[model samples]
Target: MEFLLTVLASAVGGVAAGLIVARLTRGNMTGGLLGGMIGAMAAHFTLYPSGEQALPGLLVATLQGAVGGAALGLAAGFMMKKKT
Candidate 1:
């Protein structure tokens, strides 16, 4: 249950980050979305150990996920941008 919640939070964070990055960079939304998801999940797992449960922990994880998502989304958006 907690794991699922973490994933869901991470995904939501990722989507928000992806959309923001896409809009800002005028880049590929698909790439940003995928990158955000992957980065969020990676950060969540890397930062939090299993069996931890708390409101603060969840909030921190979500923030971490968002930061990770934003970073990867930005990278992906730039890489996928078409040269003008």
Candidate 2:
């Protein structure tokens, strides 16, 4: 169940990134978290849709997932800000 574990870890990473980014940016926590979750899942599958178990691929995928999650989280945060 390495694949399952990998996805789970990625999901957890996404949640953590979402919460941290939301808190740091003072954004909508719920929106940012949801965006991060979706972005991470997309990154994970987009990188490894074939389910390859290569170490390098996994590393790259995970890194990209985190980046994607962060990007989405940041976007969500910014969108939540008032137009002051």
Q: Candidate 1's residue-wise lDDT over 1-84, tens digit each?
A: 767787778777876887688778887888788888888887777766554553235666677778888889888877887888
Give the C-alpha lDDT of model 1: 0.77
Put down candidate 2 lDDT per residue, 4-81, tens digits, no spaces.
767766766776777688889888888678878887887777766877454234455566667778878778867876
Predicted structure with the largest TM-score when compared to the true one: 1
Alpha-carbon runs more than 4 Å astray in model 2: 52-62, 81-84
- Among residues 3 or more apart in sequence or in different chains, the pairs in candidate 1 whose N, CA or C atoms overlap within 3 Å are none
- In the order shown, the candidates' Cα RMSDs to the true structure are 2.2, 2.7
lDDT of 2: 0.73
Q: Note the Cα lDDT for every prediction shown.
A: 0.77, 0.73
Of candidate 2, the 10-residue stretch with the lowest lDDT total is 52-61
